[model samples]
Target: MEILKRPMGDYQTNCYIVKIDDKEIIIDPGMGATEWVMANVKNPIAILNTHGHFDHVWSNSELQSQLNIPLYSPKGDIVLMQSSTWMPELPPSTPDIAVDGDKTLDISGIEVKFHHFPGHCPGCSMIEIGDAIFSGDFLFEGSIGRWDFPYSNAESMRESLQKFAKWTIDKPLYPGHGNPTSVRAEQRNVDYWLRIV
Candidate 1:
Protein backbone atom coordinates (compact mmCIF):
# COMPACT_ATOMS: atom_id res chain seq x y z
CA MET A 1 0.00 0.00 0.00
CA GLU A 2 1.18 3.50 -0.86
CA ILE A 3 -0.06 6.74 0.71
CA LEU A 4 0.13 10.09 -1.09
CA LYS A 5 -0.52 13.33 0.79
CA ARG A 6 -1.39 16.68 -0.82
CA PRO A 7 -2.08 19.95 0.97
CA MET A 8 -5.21 21.51 -0.44
CA GLY A 9 -7.87 24.22 -0.03
CA ASP A 10 -7.81 27.32 2.20
CA TYR A 11 -7.18 25.28 5.32
CA GLN A 12 -4.45 23.26 3.59
CA THR A 13 -6.35 20.12 4.47
CA ASN A 14 -4.46 16.91 3.78
CA CYS A 15 -5.92 14.97 0.87
CA TYR A 16 -4.74 11.38 0.81
CA ILE A 17 -4.62 8.92 -2.05
CA VAL A 18 -4.08 5.33 -1.12
CA LYS A 19 -2.94 3.12 -3.97
CA ILE A 20 -2.98 -0.64 -3.98
CA ASP A 21 -3.08 -3.12 -6.84
CA ASP A 22 -3.21 -0.36 -9.45
CA LYS A 23 -6.44 1.02 -7.96
CA GLU A 24 -6.63 4.28 -6.01
CA ILE A 25 -8.89 5.25 -3.11
CA ILE A 26 -9.06 8.98 -2.39
CA ILE A 27 -9.63 10.19 1.14
CA ASP A 28 -10.67 13.78 1.90
CA PRO A 29 -10.49 15.15 -1.64
CA GLY A 30 -10.12 18.61 -0.10
CA MET A 31 -10.18 21.04 -3.02
CA GLY A 32 -9.01 21.69 -6.59
CA ALA A 33 -6.54 18.79 -6.48
CA THR A 34 -8.68 16.32 -8.37
CA GLU A 35 -6.59 16.58 -11.53
CA TRP A 36 -3.42 16.15 -9.55
CA VAL A 37 -4.76 12.96 -7.97
CA MET A 38 -6.17 11.52 -11.21
CA ALA A 39 -2.96 12.25 -13.10
CA ASN A 40 -0.89 10.34 -10.58
CA VAL A 41 -3.03 7.27 -10.01
CA LYS A 42 -4.30 4.68 -12.47
CA ASN A 43 -7.95 3.71 -11.97
CA PRO A 44 -9.76 5.25 -9.00
CA ILE A 45 -12.10 2.84 -7.24
CA ALA A 46 -13.91 5.35 -5.02
CA ILE A 47 -13.81 8.47 -2.86
CA LEU A 48 -14.00 8.02 0.91
CA ASN A 49 -14.67 10.92 3.27
CA THR A 50 -13.85 10.52 6.94
CA HIS A 51 -16.35 13.23 7.70
CA GLY A 52 -18.44 15.80 5.86
CA HIS A 53 -16.59 18.94 6.85
CA PHE A 54 -16.13 21.61 4.17
CA ASP A 55 -12.39 21.18 4.13
CA HIS A 56 -12.62 17.40 3.74
CA VAL A 57 -15.37 16.99 1.16
CA TRP A 58 -14.78 20.06 -1.01
CA SER A 59 -13.58 18.14 -4.05
CA ASN A 60 -15.60 14.97 -3.45
CA SER A 61 -18.47 15.72 -5.80
CA GLU A 62 -16.15 16.85 -8.57
CA LEU A 63 -13.90 13.86 -8.25
CA GLN A 64 -16.75 11.40 -8.04
CA SER A 65 -18.29 12.86 -11.20
CA GLN A 66 -15.02 12.79 -13.08
CA LEU A 67 -14.12 9.25 -12.13
CA ASN A 68 -17.66 7.88 -12.06
CA ILE A 69 -16.96 6.24 -8.73
CA PRO A 70 -18.95 5.85 -5.57
CA LEU A 71 -18.60 7.97 -2.43
CA TYR A 72 -18.58 6.41 1.04
CA SER A 73 -19.24 8.11 4.39
CA PRO A 74 -20.81 7.45 7.75
CA LYS A 75 -24.61 7.48 8.04
CA GLY A 76 -24.91 10.03 10.84
CA ASP A 77 -23.18 12.89 8.98
CA ILE A 78 -25.68 13.37 6.15
CA VAL A 79 -26.79 16.66 7.72
CA LEU A 80 -23.29 18.10 7.61
CA MET A 81 -22.74 16.69 4.14
CA GLN A 82 -25.72 18.54 2.78
CA SER A 83 -24.92 21.97 4.20
CA SER A 84 -24.33 24.41 1.33
CA THR A 85 -22.88 27.10 3.58
CA TRP A 86 -20.19 24.78 4.87
CA MET A 87 -19.54 23.04 1.54
CA PRO A 88 -18.90 24.43 -1.89
CA GLU A 89 -21.17 23.67 -4.84
CA LEU A 90 -21.56 19.90 -4.96
CA PRO A 91 -22.96 17.46 -7.48
CA PRO A 92 -25.87 15.10 -6.84
CA SER A 93 -23.59 12.19 -5.98
CA THR A 94 -24.08 11.87 -2.27
CA PRO A 95 -22.54 8.99 -0.36
CA ASP A 96 -23.65 5.77 -1.99
CA ILE A 97 -22.79 3.77 1.10
CA ALA A 98 -23.50 4.88 4.66
CA VAL A 99 -21.39 2.89 7.11
CA ASP A 100 -22.12 2.26 10.77
CA GLY A 101 -19.80 1.00 13.51
CA ASP A 102 -17.09 -1.20 11.96
CA LYS A 103 -17.39 -2.26 8.35
CA THR A 104 -14.84 -3.42 5.81
CA LEU A 105 -14.81 -2.92 2.08
CA ASP A 106 -12.53 -4.54 -0.43
CA ILE A 107 -11.51 -2.11 -3.14
CA SER A 108 -9.61 -3.68 -5.99
CA GLY A 109 -8.25 -6.45 -3.76
CA ILE A 110 -7.21 -4.13 -0.93
CA GLU A 111 -9.20 -4.15 2.27
CA VAL A 112 -10.20 -0.95 4.00
CA LYS A 113 -11.96 -0.96 7.36
CA PHE A 114 -14.18 1.86 8.59
CA HIS A 115 -14.34 2.74 12.27
CA HIS A 116 -17.07 5.12 13.47
CA PHE A 117 -15.64 7.73 15.81
CA PRO A 118 -17.69 10.85 16.30
CA GLY A 119 -16.50 13.94 18.20
CA HIS A 120 -15.13 16.43 15.76
CA CYS A 121 -18.29 15.80 13.82
CA PRO A 122 -21.39 13.73 14.54
CA GLY A 123 -20.39 10.98 12.12
CA CYS A 124 -16.64 11.22 11.89
CA SER A 125 -14.90 7.93 11.05
CA MET A 126 -11.42 6.53 10.63
CA ILE A 127 -10.17 4.40 7.75
CA GLU A 128 -7.77 1.56 8.39
CA ILE A 129 -5.80 0.54 5.35
CA GLY A 130 -2.73 -1.63 5.58
CA ASP A 131 -0.69 -0.47 8.57
CA ALA A 132 -1.94 3.12 8.63
CA ILE A 133 -5.20 4.58 9.88
CA PHE A 134 -6.68 7.76 8.39
CA SER A 135 -7.87 9.38 11.62
CA GLY A 136 -9.44 12.48 10.06
CA ASP A 137 -9.96 15.17 12.74
CA PHE A 138 -10.49 12.79 15.62
CA LEU A 139 -6.87 12.24 16.68
CA PHE A 140 -3.84 14.32 15.72
CA GLU A 141 -0.14 13.93 16.41
CA GLY A 142 0.07 15.18 19.99
CA SER A 143 -3.36 16.78 20.38
CA ILE A 144 -6.99 15.71 20.00
CA GLY A 145 -9.64 17.25 17.79
CA ARG A 146 -11.47 20.44 18.82
CA TRP A 147 -15.04 20.08 20.12
CA ASP A 148 -16.24 23.65 19.68
CA PHE A 149 -18.17 23.14 16.46
CA PRO A 150 -21.95 22.72 16.45
CA TYR A 151 -21.75 18.96 15.91
CA SER A 152 -18.71 18.53 18.08
CA ASN A 153 -19.11 17.17 21.60
CA ALA A 154 -16.45 17.33 24.35
CA GLU A 155 -17.62 14.15 26.03
CA SER A 156 -17.78 12.30 22.75
CA MET A 157 -14.29 13.40 21.83
CA ARG A 158 -12.99 12.18 25.17
CA GLU A 159 -14.70 8.84 24.73
CA SER A 160 -13.31 8.47 21.23
CA LEU A 161 -9.84 9.19 22.54
CA GLN A 162 -10.21 6.49 25.14
CA LYS A 163 -11.46 4.08 22.49
CA PHE A 164 -8.43 4.86 20.34
CA ALA A 165 -6.15 4.25 23.29
CA LYS A 166 -7.57 0.75 23.59
CA TRP A 167 -6.81 -0.25 20.02
CA THR A 168 -4.16 -2.98 19.82
CA ILE A 169 -2.64 -2.04 16.51
CA ASP A 170 0.13 0.54 16.86
CA LYS A 171 -0.01 1.74 13.28
CA PRO A 172 0.97 5.17 12.00
CA LEU A 173 -1.87 7.68 12.26
CA TYR A 174 -2.59 9.80 9.21
CA PRO A 175 -4.77 12.60 10.51
CA GLY A 176 -6.56 15.27 8.46
CA HIS A 177 -4.01 17.84 9.68
CA GLY A 178 -0.43 18.13 10.84
CA ASN A 179 2.34 15.52 10.70
CA PRO A 180 1.81 11.77 10.93
CA THR A 181 2.20 9.92 14.22
CA SER A 182 2.14 6.37 15.57
CA VAL A 183 -0.67 4.98 17.70
CA ARG A 184 1.78 4.03 20.43
CA ALA A 185 3.19 7.56 20.54
CA GLU A 186 -0.29 9.05 20.75
CA GLN A 187 -1.26 6.69 23.55
CA ARG A 188 1.78 7.70 25.58
CA ASN A 189 1.59 11.46 24.87
CA VAL A 190 -2.17 11.96 24.66
CA ASP A 191 -2.61 12.03 28.41
CA TYR A 192 -2.53 15.81 28.31
CA TRP A 193 -5.94 15.97 26.62
CA LEU A 194 -7.35 12.89 28.34
CA ARG A 195 -6.46 14.12 31.82
CA ILE A 196 -8.13 17.50 31.39
CA VAL A 197 -11.63 16.21 30.73
Candidate 2:
Protein backbone atom coordinates (compact mmCIF):
# COMPACT_ATOMS: atom_id res chain seq x y z
CA MET A 1 0.00 0.00 0.00
CA GLU A 2 1.17 3.49 -0.85
CA ILE A 3 -0.21 6.68 0.71
CA LEU A 4 0.39 10.09 -0.82
CA LYS A 5 -0.43 13.39 0.87
CA ARG A 6 -1.26 16.52 -1.08
CA PRO A 7 -1.97 19.78 0.67
CA MET A 8 -4.62 21.92 -1.02
CA GLY A 9 -6.51 25.22 -0.73
CA ASP A 10 -5.89 28.12 1.66
CA TYR A 11 -6.15 25.85 4.71
CA GLN A 12 -3.61 23.42 3.27
CA THR A 13 -6.00 20.61 3.96
CA ASN A 14 -4.38 17.20 3.54
CA CYS A 15 -5.70 15.21 0.59
CA TYR A 16 -4.61 11.61 0.95
CA ILE A 17 -4.43 9.13 -1.87
CA VAL A 18 -4.29 5.51 -0.84
CA LYS A 19 -3.08 3.09 -3.44
CA ILE A 20 -3.21 -0.64 -3.06
CA ASP A 21 -2.11 -2.66 -6.05
CA ASP A 22 -4.00 -1.29 -9.09
CA LYS A 23 -6.80 0.42 -7.20
CA GLU A 24 -6.57 3.90 -5.69
CA ILE A 25 -8.86 5.65 -3.20
CA ILE A 26 -8.83 9.38 -2.53
CA ILE A 27 -9.56 10.88 0.84
CA ASP A 28 -10.42 14.60 1.00
CA PRO A 29 -9.87 15.94 -2.49
CA GLY A 30 -9.69 19.57 -1.50
CA MET A 31 -9.07 22.52 -3.85
CA GLY A 32 -6.37 22.14 -6.53
CA ALA A 33 -6.53 18.34 -6.54
CA THR A 34 -8.48 17.89 -9.76
CA GLU A 35 -5.50 18.69 -11.95
CA TRP A 36 -3.12 16.80 -9.73
CA VAL A 37 -5.24 13.68 -9.61
CA MET A 38 -5.83 13.79 -13.34
CA ALA A 39 -2.13 13.91 -14.00
CA ASN A 40 -1.08 11.48 -11.31
CA VAL A 41 -3.51 8.84 -10.08
CA LYS A 42 -4.52 5.72 -11.92
CA ASN A 43 -7.50 3.46 -11.53
CA PRO A 44 -9.22 5.55 -8.84
CA ILE A 45 -11.99 3.36 -7.49
CA ALA A 46 -13.74 5.66 -5.01
CA ILE A 47 -13.60 8.68 -2.66
CA LEU A 48 -13.76 8.43 1.11
CA ASN A 49 -14.44 11.60 3.03
CA THR A 50 -14.01 12.12 6.74
CA HIS A 51 -16.42 15.01 6.95
CA GLY A 52 -18.11 17.67 4.80
CA HIS A 53 -16.21 20.82 5.63
CA PHE A 54 -15.53 23.02 2.58
CA ASP A 55 -11.77 22.58 2.69
CA HIS A 56 -12.30 18.83 2.68
CA VAL A 57 -14.97 18.61 0.01
CA TRP A 58 -14.16 21.52 -2.27
CA SER A 59 -12.93 19.46 -5.19
CA ASN A 60 -15.10 16.44 -4.43
CA SER A 61 -17.64 17.12 -7.14
CA GLU A 62 -15.08 17.89 -9.78
CA LEU A 63 -12.91 14.90 -8.93
CA GLN A 64 -15.87 12.55 -8.66
CA SER A 65 -17.18 13.77 -12.00
CA GLN A 66 -13.84 13.48 -13.68
CA LEU A 67 -12.93 10.15 -12.18
CA ASN A 68 -16.50 8.91 -12.42
CA ILE A 69 -16.26 7.38 -8.98
CA PRO A 70 -18.53 7.19 -6.00
CA LEU A 71 -18.14 9.52 -2.96
CA TYR A 72 -18.73 8.31 0.59
CA SER A 73 -19.25 10.76 3.48
CA PRO A 74 -20.81 10.82 6.89
CA LYS A 75 -24.53 11.62 6.74
CA GLY A 76 -24.35 13.68 9.93
CA ASP A 77 -22.90 16.81 8.35
CA ILE A 78 -25.16 17.30 5.38
CA VAL A 79 -25.82 20.91 6.42
CA LEU A 80 -22.13 21.82 6.27
CA MET A 81 -21.73 19.91 3.01
CA GLN A 82 -24.58 21.75 1.30
CA SER A 83 -23.68 25.25 2.47
CA SER A 84 -21.03 26.89 4.62
CA THR A 85 -21.57 30.50 5.68
CA TRP A 86 -17.82 31.11 5.99
CA MET A 87 -16.28 29.34 3.01
CA PRO A 88 -16.19 30.47 -0.58
CA GLU A 89 -18.70 29.14 -3.11
CA LEU A 90 -18.42 25.38 -3.60
CA PRO A 91 -19.85 22.80 -5.96
CA PRO A 92 -22.43 20.67 -4.18
CA SER A 93 -22.79 16.96 -4.79
CA THR A 94 -24.74 14.61 -2.59
CA PRO A 95 -22.65 11.82 -1.11
CA ASP A 96 -23.10 8.60 -3.05
CA ILE A 97 -22.71 6.62 0.19
CA ALA A 98 -23.64 8.10 3.56
CA VAL A 99 -22.11 6.57 6.68
CA ASP A 100 -23.92 7.36 9.92
CA GLY A 101 -22.10 4.96 12.19
CA ASP A 102 -19.17 2.59 12.43
CA LYS A 103 -19.05 0.28 9.45
CA THR A 104 -16.66 -1.54 7.16
CA LEU A 105 -16.86 -1.30 3.38
CA ASP A 106 -15.02 -2.78 0.49
CA ILE A 107 -14.06 -0.52 -2.35
CA SER A 108 -13.30 -2.96 -5.12
CA GLY A 109 -10.94 -5.26 -3.19
CA ILE A 110 -9.65 -2.85 -0.49
CA GLU A 111 -11.29 -2.88 2.92
CA VAL A 112 -11.98 0.47 4.61
CA LYS A 113 -13.62 1.16 7.92
CA PHE A 114 -15.40 4.30 9.13
CA HIS A 115 -15.70 5.39 12.75
CA HIS A 116 -17.97 8.29 13.67
CA PHE A 117 -16.53 10.82 16.11
CA PRO A 118 -18.83 13.80 15.98
CA GLY A 119 -17.23 16.88 17.52
CA HIS A 120 -15.61 19.51 15.33
CA CYS A 121 -18.58 18.95 13.03
CA PRO A 122 -21.72 16.93 13.40
CA GLY A 123 -20.48 14.36 10.96
CA CYS A 124 -16.82 14.23 11.90
CA SER A 125 -15.35 10.78 11.27
CA MET A 126 -12.16 8.81 10.73
CA ILE A 127 -11.27 6.07 8.28
CA GLU A 128 -9.07 3.15 9.16
CA ILE A 129 -7.21 1.06 6.60
CA GLY A 130 -4.61 -1.47 7.55
CA ASP A 131 -2.51 0.01 10.37
CA ALA A 132 -3.13 3.62 9.46
CA ILE A 133 -6.05 5.96 10.11
CA PHE A 134 -7.18 9.06 8.24
CA SER A 135 -8.26 11.25 11.09
CA GLY A 136 -10.16 14.17 9.62
CA ASP A 137 -10.69 17.22 11.85
CA PHE A 138 -11.38 15.16 14.89
CA LEU A 139 -7.77 14.85 16.07
CA PHE A 140 -4.47 16.45 15.09
CA GLU A 141 -0.84 15.84 16.04
CA GLY A 142 -0.79 17.59 19.39
CA SER A 143 -4.27 19.13 19.34
CA ILE A 144 -7.89 18.24 18.81
CA GLY A 145 -10.51 19.80 16.54
CA ARG A 146 -12.37 23.02 17.29
CA TRP A 147 -15.87 22.59 18.64
CA ASP A 148 -16.91 26.22 18.30
CA PHE A 149 -18.44 25.92 14.85
CA PRO A 150 -22.14 26.00 14.07
CA TYR A 151 -22.91 22.32 14.50
CA SER A 152 -20.00 21.52 16.78
CA ASN A 153 -20.45 20.12 20.24
CA ALA A 154 -17.73 20.27 22.89
CA GLU A 155 -19.18 17.42 24.90
CA SER A 156 -19.16 15.23 21.87
CA MET A 157 -15.56 16.06 21.11
CA ARG A 158 -14.56 15.22 24.67
CA GLU A 159 -16.33 11.94 24.49
CA SER A 160 -14.72 11.20 21.17
CA LEU A 161 -11.32 12.03 22.59
CA GLN A 162 -11.90 9.67 25.48
CA LYS A 163 -13.05 7.00 23.13
CA PHE A 164 -10.01 7.54 20.96
CA ALA A 165 -7.70 7.31 23.95
CA LYS A 166 -8.92 3.81 24.52
CA TRP A 167 -8.02 2.51 21.07
CA THR A 168 -4.81 0.69 20.14
CA ILE A 169 -1.99 3.11 20.73
CA ASP A 170 0.49 2.22 18.01
CA LYS A 171 -1.06 2.94 14.63
CA PRO A 172 0.03 5.82 12.40
CA LEU A 173 -2.39 8.77 12.35
CA TYR A 174 -2.90 10.85 9.23
CA PRO A 175 -4.82 13.92 10.20
CA GLY A 176 -6.63 16.61 8.19
CA HIS A 177 -3.98 19.23 8.85
CA GLY A 178 -0.26 19.32 9.58
CA ASN A 179 2.10 16.34 9.42
CA PRO A 180 1.25 12.77 10.28
CA THR A 181 1.33 11.43 13.86
CA SER A 182 0.52 8.27 15.76
CA VAL A 183 -2.20 7.04 18.09
CA ARG A 184 0.17 6.66 21.03
CA ALA A 185 1.66 10.10 20.48
CA GLU A 186 -1.77 11.69 20.20
CA GLN A 187 -2.99 9.89 23.30
CA ARG A 188 -0.20 11.56 25.20
CA ASN A 189 -0.51 14.94 23.50
CA VAL A 190 -4.26 15.09 24.03
CA ASP A 191 -4.11 14.25 27.71
CA TYR A 192 -4.58 17.89 28.68
CA TRP A 193 -7.62 18.30 26.45
CA LEU A 194 -9.20 15.20 27.90
CA ARG A 195 -8.80 16.66 31.38
CA ILE A 196 -11.09 19.53 30.46
CA VAL A 197 -14.68 19.34 31.61
Best by TM-score: 2
lDDT of 2 at 21: 88
- Compared with the true structure, model 1 gives a TM-score of 0.93
**What is the C-alpha local distance difference test score of candidate 1?**
0.83
Q: Give all candidates' CA lDDT scores.
A: 0.83, 0.87
Report RMSD (Å) for each prediction in the order shown: 1.7, 1.2
Error of 1 at 154 (Å): 1.1
The Cα error of candidate 1 at residue 86, in Å, is 4.3
Error of 1 at 96 (Å): 0.9
lDDT of 1 at 40: 78
| Deviation from truth (RMSD, Å), model 2 | 1.2
Residue pairs of candidate 2 with colliding backbone atoms: none
